[model samples]
Target: MSETQNFIILGGSGAGLGVAHSFLKHIEPELRKLGKKYHLYIIDSSSHFFWNTGSPRSVVSAALLPAEKLFAPIADGFKSYDSSLYTVIHGTAVSWDVGGRTVTVELANDQNTQTTLPYYALVLATGTRTPSPATSLHGDHTITKAAIEDLNKKFASAVSVIVSGGGPTGVEVAGEAGHFLNGSAGWFSSRPSNPKAKVTLVTNRDKLLPVLSKPRALTAEIYLNQVGVDVVYNVSVVSSTTDADGKTTVHLSNGEQWTADVYIPAWGITPNSSYAPADLKNDQGYIKTNHATLRAEAAGPRVYVAGDVGDYSRGGFHNLYATIPVIVANIKRDLLEAATSSDGSDSQPNEPDRLFTPNNSETQAVPIGPRGVGAVNGWGLPSFLIWLVKGRDYMIRNVSATVNGNMV
Candidate 1:
């Protein structure tokens, strides 16, 4: 096989795994039949992978699979392959050179030794970074052990807690905090208490779960209220300060202030594009891609993008269900030298052509305490069942199984 067909994948999170799985499921068979040899290199900084969506539950129940359980050793998972066919490196990519087709990665322990891995094709699946205050205020920011420890300490002493932001992450944190304070009747004999630890969920939006429909939003509000969370709507925080007494004073834009023992900032996320190749990125620092094809719009053939870093009109929630299939098909076609055309297209397309088109099936599900509100394909389903399926279990088992290659 030519060196140009070899693949180097950056970021081994959901997106990275998705692309790798796609290649294995769709493209591997064709390559094996043709007796073609292709190298696949997977790189990530961390050895552990946590199910981020399940983090709220981790904070509340303190029940989480160990870091090793949540992730498969990258080397072990690919050990069967020849060294030339597949390799997994534990390092952080400092930057990429588009013109040279090289990626510079710094080893975890040996920061001084930087290695450049030249690739025929590159997949930029490095997801977004968590927001500033959230990432800065706490260590192990990516919903890992260290982050849960920080929250646990606050929960132990907090009399009142303030959760800023009304988005899915904020809502989940607020609801989970309430559950931690109130305790579970079925699971525990006594409820946990910080006595003064009241949870106040502050949202600038007029309603909770603004992305969901009115009915679902109302359902989430009801659930939160029932769990003893103080819902403050249409209020924005102007400034926050820590008093001499070690309490946090949050000044609201609506001319109100509240004191809390702990405050959690669950604001939105921004893409982490600083380490990526500049030429492959758009003005927003997100990778510019043919939404249909999932290939870099500027880079030539073989390179592809998936998950959060890729600019897709369908938004975050839908990208999981939509982009994976297209990426798989494209990779397979590229391996077989098949025509790079859509299913019904008459002519093969050039590099950087749109391979997939998105539909307006974007949906979001927010878990409020033990109940949840969801919009399926823009259709509202205000039910407590959504929470039962997602909120209660946090999908930890499913994620663990996937990382273990069980296909659960």
Candidate 2:
């Protein structure tokens, strides 16, 4: 390894950006003291970073602000420290050469250029991708970009739409689609009138937001019903097929068939780990890591995995809140080390004993439509105050200001 170590981070979403910010804050001073410069590079395929919280809202109204408005350009954001020390590449990592300590990345340009970056340390913060909806037996197709686009196109022309899946994403999609349908009449009043669209939400779970507490789940159900969405529960999708007229027919396990112009699958997401090495992954293909150290289980040293890509064995919601700080701490420790003293001192710091499990208070607040459902310890609370605090604006403006160095 060179005296000046290079850090290559994969994925440029919430986890990746959070890791970058944490690295700059935690490790820069130590590197400066050592008279060494640390180089940081981030690889992501998209030019713009999408706020996950804003995705559902964007799909509904197509009113999401531009990528520039959401995230600061990675290069510019790191330039103040040292432009040469940090670089952002628009590329997709096709494979990793673990033995050679290199990653092969395919650039997004037409030339189809490929480059291998050698890293002393690699941080895998790549988040999950939307699952393919076609093969989802549970009828979860509403979360992906393609599925959302298809739903919008169908809803614009059809009279009815059915959304399957009862999770946060599913409920959000169903509600948003319902709102879109209700507004389409006004949006196209001057144009040729289209038939009114109806939205039905189906879930195999007994109640909407089943992960939430009873009161909160009931509140969510009531709110969804108020918005003209038919909430059906305890039903499973046995099969789905499209007819000649382009309408989708869904067969229920209970022996019922319902046809709709558009059927949205909004099941859930699996971690994106195809780029990761097989030995480093768990049975589900999620990278396995030491939660306290954030080090890859199979990697001997100087390699870490963070964010949704890592399997903490606790839960799947390993994003900005839980994993980023640990990644930062581990990276800082690796990058800053004192020379061996004349007494032949051991270089590694005493491993700080820490618990890796999530606290009971660690809960995610999910917003259904404009209203928010605050979940604490996996218990949901029916409160519009939570929505006002974080949901109403979708935190886009705040994140934008933070990244772009501008007030929203």
Candidate 3:
């Protein structure tokens, strides 16, 4: 019998889940042809995978749609595969011994108990950690969904809403809140028509969606303005305090002050690479990778990385979509080479691992309410297409379909 190699993937979101599903549905068949056996273990602290790209809108519309739609069980994606071939561990990866090819994970059910996993290869797709509603990293979908639902209740009654950050998340939040108040008749009936009832967006940059093309940025600003969202540019939130009345006062770097009943900070995310070797990380703590191969720079060739945790020039769903295929290909190549080698011997250098060549460029789609705007490969997209593609339901329906086994 061939020795069964172990492949451990640490993450259950976009990149990690993408590779795992593709491997089971596509690559595993090829490996079976080579008469190689392996156990693929996917570990994540959360039992369910949160579709964070749609989180902004989901949080705002929690009352209209079921919170369950925002999360999908990680194990559900692997149901079609053989039980012995793949296992999903519900735990947080705390530490790793790269030299020994062992990883320590903190089990979600029992925090005090830890489990060590030995692997022939490891794929790091832990992604990033961000504030709730922007990216839920609570490791529990129920808690995250409940928190967002409570926040939506707060938003429903709030006279004023302030969202800090001009990036995609903030823009989406502002747009969704504004649209909910202006468009939702049932939600609007409760609140009095005070002009003060506003959705304010604060950003340090001069333009909304600064990383996007100028045309796209302008389009986004126009959409937000049309939806009654106040875009406050060139200002940063210095501090915030809540008063007895429950209204919070936000102090800005420009010496401006604003009071709002609801406040959300969508500033950014921190890369979830605490287990990564210091030498493999950049100043911002993102794992440095060989972009061509998606391999960790300082880690051995057996280790790879993808998604937001990777030190790619840009991090987004489109980038992840383009990157995961490369990661899967490289992992398959390495596995095939290992399978061809004789017992206890490394394969000759005749066949090298395939390099990941990215065919797609940086692409972003920022949905604002029923309208949308974005750029793909330096080309701007029309509002109708953006609306049809993402703004309609913020891709929630698509994610829900995948969870229902329709698109998976």
Report every candidate's CA lDDT. 0.66, 0.64, 0.78
Stronger candidate by lDDT (2 vs 3): 3
Off by over 4 Å in 2: 1-3, 63-76, 110-112, 132-158, 182-196, 236-257, 313-319, 338-347, 351-357, 360-362, 377-382, 401-408
Per-residue alpha-carbon lDDT of candidate 3 for residues 1-408, written as tens digits (9 for 90 to 100): 477878899998777887887777777777788888778999998898887767787677666555677788888867777898999999989998878879999999999999998888888999887765435666677777877776777777877899999999999988888877765223344322443358889999988886687767877887787667878889999988978876789999988898898888888788888877787799999988888888884777578897889887377666667787678877777777777777642343355656665535536788887778887887877878988898776678666444433443
Stretches > 4 Å off in candidate 1: 1-5, 61-76, 79-84, 132-143, 183-196, 238-257, 277-279, 313-318, 338-354, 405-408
Model 1 Cα lDDT, one tens digit per residue, 1-408: 422355788877666776775666557656766656567888777655445676555554344323322334555545444556667777788888887878898886688989898876678877776552223212122435665565666666676989888878888888777766764323332233332357889988888766677777776766666566777888887888987766789899889898887777666566656777677677778888887778884776677887787766334445565676677777666656532334622234355433666655537877777667787788775557676667656666666444434441
Per-model TM-score, in order, reads: 0.83, 0.80, 0.90
TM value for model 1: 0.83
Ranking by TM-score: 3, 1, 2
lDDT-best of 1 and 2: 1
Weakest lDDT window of 10 consecutive positions for candidate 3? 184-193
* Model 1, backbone clash pairs (residues 3+ apart or across chains), number: 7
RMSD of each: 5.1, 6.1, 3.7
